[model samples]
Target: MRQANGDVRVGGPVNNRDVAEAHNYHAATKHSYWSVRLGGHFLDWANKPHPHKVYQGLPVVPLPCDVTPPTMAALEAVAAFPSMGTSIRNLAELAQVLFFCGGLTKKKVYPGGEAQYFRAASCTGGLYEIEIYAVCGDLPGLSAGVYHFCPADFALRRLRAGDLRGELARATADEESISDAPVILVLTAIFWRNAWKYQARAYRHFYWDAGTILANLLATAAATQLASRIVAGFIDTRVDRLLGLDSEREGSLCLVPIGAHSPAAEPSEVLPIAPETVPLSKREVDYPLITQIRAASMLLSEEEVRVWRSGFAPSPPPPINRKCFPLNTIKRDALPNRTLGEVIIRRGSTRQFAQLPISFRQLSTILERSSRGIPADFLGGSGTTLLDTYLVVNSVENLPTGAFYYSPSEQALELLKEGTFRRKAGYLCLEQGLGIEASVIIFFLADLDRILERYGNRGYGAAQLEAGIVGGKIYLCAYALGLGATGTTFYDDDVTEFFSPHAAGKAALFAVAIGHSARVPGRVKLLAPGAR
Candidate 1:
């Protein structure tokens, strides 16, 4: 294994109880909540990390702007989750998928005169660290090879000049899905990108942010009728080397096989390329803690991948001893059929929302879609839930606004209390006003104690990934309804308390705000040449 500063040995199989305790202690004492506040004040946003990956004098191609695919037809939202079979297997379709999933969506001029461009998913610190690469067989227009997605120009730059899905399939130890996939999406995170703001915890945000993006990718693929699955357990270094990424600086997170094929692919001639890449920022500042936690959880071999992937087990429900609230259930057809594409196009982090009451039906639709079973490898085959969802209902028609617990099994919202928590909601989300402005805020709480104890250090990976998948789905669902949604960070303990007895000991995993957006006049175009 490539050694780096602060790297820990996360190289073994651990049970659930041990993993859970490690996570709990890490969150409570070792890393602790209070440490974050102090750390935040010390951060230098002015001296924030730079964006460009400085290739210096390396010969690089400026991908064409025409690489972006046009947005597709919006399909109505369906309650039942369908496993997509085929897709728009063309260059244009591929470009569209890439753009919608990772392209720059909008640009805003900060009051300080800084123009910040946002992407398809809501990132923790808006640090676009996660990079996407494509490995495929010959398609409609593009060639068969490995290509890096250049979001700046919305194009792909060829790296390896031959079909390499076979190599990936082999690296993944002949995982059936990859063996039959026409295209595979590889997601890798550049550490310093997000760690600039969140420091060590930013490692987790890598999964969180990427998960949200994957959510968009999966939903869009489904709309196009493409088959895709999240493959978290893989030979990390092998895939990293295939993409020619510096494993210490940027590491592969997950692999997604898009579109199905009848026959398996043959392995490519694996050549080792140690081409020197660019530095992400002008002068690099290192954060040891981030690397330590990441290294502790890295999976080294194909056998290890299989072990980690199979070792996962769903978190057991909280003991039935506590008094649970009654829930509000709705019919499946009551949901709208807004095509997933339409939702993604119109979707944005609700920068501003009218605190107007949304109909209870809207709330019901979001809950239904967000919690619908997700297809993932870590999920243990049975739509298993790795995180618990709790909500701070700010306002909704006929629903008393307060905190509540979502029972996916019951398909209902169990009322935990009845009152307004707009201010508390905002406060809990580190004072981001979006929380208070949103109609409903959903918080993902995981029993880290139980999870880590069962899965070991790697449990952290499953928990974050699960939250991201669900959170990402909720984003699409909100947009499908013509509403808006954005992922937000929160004060872990405060969230549990705000939800009270129902969520007392549970730690906050992730959060999202759902509501009507303050519509911008004229469809705001993003990434238009010279438009900024």
Candidate 2:
């Protein structure tokens, strides 16, 4: 399953010659035509690769030792460490980073008595395929080595001996971030794990789920005053080998360098070691298309990596005259005053939305705050949005319950179609009730044809990142407003269909439901950095 270089195709036959051959300018129209005329083959769910990757008859080694859980408040408070110039003096800091990023956040029991442990961030389908490994020098409490984080036991299992951070730096062409940081967090996704439920498109989930976790991590790092950036361009195989991951089952997705100004890491003198990890699930499943797509989009040469690192292909000029709203401006005092720390600690995806209505002011503030310019190189300028926003208004004061397109250009909602489609909303979101019950559901739709033609595979990264940045902001905004929100997976075609004519030709990027939660005051824990 390992390719000599990263040259795998992403979408395979779905976005191939025949599909691309169609001159479909409007995605919603194209989607509607396919669903109504072709009997539902356009947005292919049948081909969704399995979401979980199961391995059987494997070794299960307990992590070296038990580690203490970091103080929740301390964990949440230190979003960026180096910003404060605080040195990481001992082994405890490393443990804090590992646990906070990947530790279990909560547990729940089902009617059948089965227990499910949720993680630090909400994931689509709660299917977590992302895995984290550490590469660093020996610190205060532990030895220098490559180790995989086992969230179940809250311990680290050594995968290789000694410092391999230099090898990683070289693999990334000495990506400056990795070279200077004391510890680098390497993230990889097990193909079959998420592919099982989402199928080939699980490839996107690799980044979507990852982006959410990265949001938490970045925020946590920011609270700590540590400089962190997401690095995608690198020699894939070299990093895979260093981590001893079976390229067939899992591969490196991104690398995050944390902390600054420690002694330079020395490369390991020992040859590459391939130690075995115990099997995680019962039986291994295969998703060839997903593997194929991931491999195709991979970066091979340092030249290709460098070439693909930047540049958005020539985007078609914006419409000479399309009527869209300029995003509404907000008064500073009217905005939610909760600090970033308070918001993150209290945030959780809404499971049930009260039919009770949210105030027009609260809703307006969220739309404004979440749409504010994101800080990204891909964004031409601050406040630039890569994707358009559309909404299904179930209920809002002074607003009709129908489908509306957010003309950020006009800062007003353009009524696309006037109809109550609560049932349609639920169906579009894989039949989730939250969509129907929420005050309004926001859907991010992108012009992928333009994006891909301009940025290639990296465009997908930028789009998802933008959605995540805003989505993360949405979480903060909602919590600060005393509302609730949750990120969700949706039926691609149905969303476009619901917003049709207006949303034609656009592809679904991300979905989040905002409303109210059902938990009691103290039921949901809220801890910030340094808090217990």
Candidate 3:
């Protein structure tokens, strides 16, 4: 049974043991050249959970079938961070945003009875563990309720039928963005779905995968003219209970409140809900570390939530007395005319990158545009970021091969060291061939010690989430400019060592490789099911 405050009656309180467990897990999951070889973990294909969630009894509300293409330019969408403006208003706009961000975009078939369903954002191990749920107030073509987005069917299954935005507002400690929003999207991760392949480290994938999806969601909202803000600091129990999630298996990761200008809904009673869901697989394996980390990071009380949401100032960039190579970016007018929707539909992770160089303009455009910062409550304000980006350049016209740190504030790359290190790049990225083959590798590093001190363990999630969002934008921009990009796993400490003493104390959060793809034309179709 669920309580009025939205806590499921679990056995006992999670305590210091849980926090210790999470810490141990993080230490254990770090990949070293030797650790990877010794682990001997293999994918258990036979027990793979169904990628889609199915609710048996809920009424299905199909989103508009004919979604119009957004007219916002791809680059503009990546850079747009609107606040307190237009609302989503109707079902069509909502559908457009949802489809572009998380809908099933394509189906791929491999030789030996293997088929993969790909979405707009790239996922590690191609395991789609993230799930999207919408909690909203009444609007055109829909009613107030909590609904689960069924991507396979392009519909939402109503889980609880009522205006539940108030519960969310409370969960977030009345964060202005959420209280004023007409619609809130909660992204959750199913542990076993990803852990089957990633093992204990699947906990990290939870935020990485969700971050990529948020990247698309934020851009799509911007393209459709809806103001969006991410709410990462919330009462975890209240949210999980509000969504009827079993905290042990599935839990809320982050919340996105879409639209603006609506008055805060009056507080209302949230009734108990125990919706029946189809089993993801015949059986499920439990990962205690996942539950422990989530519980440890959770803000237990509304007061705690409010205090946590106050936010912290990121450490200022190191003194810039040296010569900074300013990026030569293309003007907005000269950017490709492709719309964000069109680019997302055609976007895919590059499986194989050609050993050719991309123009400096292309690389500069991505850096200059995507680093504008995200609009979120945890960031304290727009134009602030929790992570810093560094790069290893193997090939780019007019730029020497070397290691550099991207100073977004100066719109320049601070050259740290100069020389070819493609082999080292390949080694740092967990020995992936994509590292050496791609034209350049971007590494997102953060000062975890400072972040954790300021925001506690939850800051770890915030940093990883922000990195994934920025990396995802790079994917869209790369595809928009006829280049290819793919996210990669890395040897964490080794990455810091490679870019030392500049990146010395920072921890590597995420990495992406960008260049031209070696695949044949038309081998993988990127168009939506019925589009020109």
Candidate 4:
């Protein structure tokens, strides 16, 4: 019964021969009319998961808040590589990266006295399930230890007191890129936090949410002149053991090594321990589907990780020889003058988009800025990505109203079937007004067959995560230009069908709507803060 989209049976360990768990999970989670009509899922507000995870009885190490905010232009900062020839000199600089990446940037108190803390990265359901931890050799102003970043109070809680980069390097198949780094940041997700709202589908958010933070993490690192890269191919259980996490309830997602100077690290020695924790809720409901798919995606051994990373060569799809609209983006000198830290602080998902047209330059700038390429382990080699961008242009300065495919190589939009598709665009995005009202909606589609064949079910997670990263970049780019943006869910099969032949075998992974915010009239003006 593995027909996908509807009839598919996925059970037991997923092998290379049977890589249908991702297909099944993707199919099972599709948001179609029939599925939504029949599947009744409701939020249990009384049992909501706590917003923060606190380690009981650990000494608090407050991070410095006076770290200088990065002054580089947000567009150039987000678009450039983190290969700068500089290093993280002290904890304040690292704190700058951490704060911009995951720390709370602003707090809003509602009239009801309920205080809401907005984090740097955009999270699903505002449920911040992702957690950040650091493992490092000794560095200025900080010691060699394993510490969890407590964003609630802007502090670190030490979990182990020793250098563990060697252990981390080994868990990542001796990835040499991170060997000389003074610090490595590990991202993990606690199951119950997001599952409280999304159920089994929360597994997908593990990466989607992290991808947003990573978008900021990479940009901030580059702005701070630190070299960094995302390592996704690591021994899952080993990393979990390193973090001393309860494997089923919480697990590692990826590791990022920052800076390039450090001494050799000692091997990790983690004892069997479950540190005490504050309860997240009065009770937690278990989602077996999450565990099932997470297991299906796990790499059992270090050698397996190496092999998986080695085989991550997904043959590029057929090239787009037919370039349609030539892209005209802003010149480097004319790019936005806003600092990344300032844009991050002011950024919020646009809840209301004005029914207006954004200049062609703005549209092209966002595309060019976000598609420069992402730096992650799964995406080996230069400019490698699994998802292709498709667009439904509703209103723009000079562009025609139609659906088109974005060719990063050609720097052009391949004209798919052209015509006004506002109604169709809204329907594809689950009948949301935001999709219809926005000047344009961007859809990310991935070739699951090719990706799964190369990296097994785990590639599914990477694809979603990558989409999130690109969407996150689009979000930041929009805000930097004094516009607004928001992420939206789509009707999977319908999106693929709308772009036929060109998008035939692709799976719809993510979508984002971008345009001017309604709160401000015509076009909002942004202040350019002077950078250091």
Q: What is the TM-score of each candidate against the true structure?
A: 0.86, 0.76, 0.94, 0.93
Q: Better model by TM-score, 3 or 4?
A: 3
Model 3 misplaced stretches (Cα beyond 4 Å): 1-23, 111-114, 321-323, 520-522, 526-532
lDDT of each: 0.70, 0.63, 0.83, 0.82
How does model 1 score by TM-score?
Answer: 0.86
User: Of the candidates shown, which would achieve the greatest TM-score relative to the real structure?
Assistant: 3
In the range 74-163, model 4's lDDT, one tens digit per residue, is 998889878544767787877888888887766655555666667888888889999999987777878888889987777888888778
Estimate, for each residue in 1-532, the C-alpha lDDT of model 1 and write its tens digit.
Answer: 2222442344464332345434633463223347555543356656666653443333343443454332343323223333457734767667767777887777766555667777766677678888898888888777787888766655576777778888788777778778788888899888887866766667778888888888787766766667877777677667988988777688888898888873446875677866555555555556655555556566666776676667456645554433354444445565455655456655677778888778787777677666766667677553578888888888888888787778777666677777878998888877888888999999898877666665556678768887987788888777776788888888877777777687877777788898888754334545542123
Q: What is the C-alpha lDDT profile of model 2 across 1-532, one tens digit per residue?
A: 2222222334434322222322231232222324444432232344443332332333333332333432324222322222323334445666555555655656555656665556666666677888888777767766777777766665566777677788877777766767777777888988766755554556667777776776666656655556666676677878888887788888888887777675557565536555655554445546565555445556666665656556443344234244333433346555545555445544567778886677666667677656655333345444566788888888776677778777554557777777888888887776778778888888888887777665555566557766765676566567767888888767787787777776788888888778776653224333322222
Q: Pick the candidate with the highest lDDT.
A: 3
Candidates by lDDT, descending order:
3, 4, 1, 2
Instruction: Please say which candidate is ahead in TM-score: 1 or 2.
Output: 1
Clashes of each: 21, 68, 0, 0
The TM-score, computed over Cα atoms with residue i paired to residue i, of candidate 3 is 0.94
Better of 2 and 4 by TM-score: 4
> Among all windows of ten consecutive residues in candidate 1, which has the lowest summed lDDT?
73-82
Candidate 2: which stretches are off by over 4 Å? 1-90, 262-271, 313-346, 371-385, 398-400, 406-419, 500-502, 518-532
